[model samples]
Target: MNDDTGGGPARGVSGGSWERATLEKLVFATLKEQRSVRRWRMFSRLLWLAVLGAIAWYFLQQQTLGAVQSTPHTAVIEIRGEIASGASASADSIVSSLKTAFEDRGAQAVVLLIDSPGGSPVQAGIINDEITRLKGLHKKKVYAVVEETCASAAYYIAAAADEIYVDKASLVGSIGVLMDGFGFTGLMEKLGIERRLMTAGENKAMLDPFSPQNPEQSAYIQNMLGEIHGQFIEVVKRGRGARLKETPDMFSGLVWSGPRAVELGLADGLGSLDTVARDVVKAEDIVDYTQRENLGSRLARQFGASVGEGFFLAAKASGVQLK
Candidate 1:
């Protein structure tokens, strides 16, 4: 049979170098067989690159959409969520929002939308101080529109507003100070758990759960509450001025529904954010400046806050009140 070019395998360079010719043919055949694999691999890599590019584009678009924007023409700020020390929705957040509103040339008046049950008295006072400062410095009118629940420290914050509004059913008031925790001395005894505590002053651990309540301790804690209460009362008096019709029972740490709140001068009007913006501000446009609490921290706070509030309400119901 002919091995190459119709000639049998021969000596080197004989019959047109039959062996070299056969080798060339074999090499050419291998290259032809590999061509499809190389081309397909390149195509697949290109396709994957395109897919990754699309995914990156989608994420970029989502981020832009999720970012908060400053509202032009009218500046509306929010103080929703719990107000606490160093919280995202705390005094600093509201203060910064007010500052931004005042600085914005398009903002006619700063709108403060509040939705909180209040928090630290110190935080609330700081917020009130900042509101006063911003108003004085900027000479801009600020309105506090209450939503859901603007009680206690929330009202303290709202008191600094030029006007106040609440929904018909929104909970308001709770104009008092409180501190609640468990007394676990008995529980510790039952659980056989020893509580190790140290303090320079005997009164330093007055509120400690593991410590037994002393008469002097009770007196001291009451005095502290009274002092905070007085500060809260003064803030409300200053904010509402003569509009506030102070009742004997109003400021006893009692929370009320919006209707009673409006009737008692705790809240000026009754309506939600939508109604207030449309009718009160006379502008449909609104902006939010409130910072949302992260899920982890928010949930962590929920239990303690709710339990403390439940006890506080029970105490208030038993005869104590707030205005």
Candidate 2:
């Protein structure tokens, strides 16, 4: 029995040391956690600031780039996409740009820089009428300079111009109207699917793809298309006048080479935007006068439109669409 009571003091000191080590580990872990939280918070704030800065820069850039100057130039309005109501080449956008270009005293001539396969006839008609009206009011010559393809409604718009120019390789005409869709009645029968369509009006579901075709409705649609076609032909005739060489196949929804188009009087000559500006208009400087929706605005509009479209599609029956 070598005095066990003396070891009690040593045990107490060892226990105290163990307690101190445990407390130190806890404090270090707590500080590390706090540091990690601070780093994450800082990173989040930096990311938020970067986003704000980017948005600010985009707006500033748009403001700077969209500014119009009172300098002499050939004001060019680009019709480079579909001519639908919401498209860049829509009557609204093109007409607005044309108005600006024509109103600008510095603009020597208003040039329509067209590169499109065409779209809505209604949209084209609006643009055409506006072009004619603006030309008469402003006393400024409107010229159509084709790049890739200017057909159908695009040609309709070009017809309003004083002169139509094209590159040798460019496709220049497709003077026609069309309504296209699919008939799914046979497919539905094969799949044993019943189409239960209800409408308040008799002709409400007249062109429904899921339903059987009505002969009267078909004839009506054909007559409607023929009338529209006649209107298109008359417009072409009025615009081209003695320049057009009358041919059966000319207005048969057929596209022609730029040289052929020029020969047929669909186009005045083979010339580029540069040539038209420098040689024809006598203004070398070119300024873009096309009013365009900015990226952010377009994105927002498209998103909203897509959401609305889903509901519209669900509620409506499939039908014919014009191109």
Model 2 lDDT tens row, 136-252: 898999999999999999999999988999999999889999999889999999999999988999999988999999999999999999999999998889888999997899989
Q: Best lDDT goes to which candidate? A: 2
CA displacement after TM-score superposition, residue 146 of candidate 2 (Å): 0.5
**TM-score of every prediction relative to native:** 0.66, 0.73
Give per-residue CA lDDT, model 1, range 144-170, as digits (tens): 888788888889989998888888778
> Which consecutive 10 residues in model 2 have the weakest lDDT in total?
314-323
Residue pairs in clash, model 2: none
Q: TM-score of predicted model 2?
A: 0.73
With a 3 Å backbone cut-off (N, CA, C), the pairs that clash in candidate 1 are 250-322, 250-323, 251-321, 251-322, 251-323, 252-321, 252-322, 253-321, 253-322
Q: Native-vs-model 1 lDDT? A: 0.74
The lDDT for every candidate, in the order shown, is 0.74, 0.86
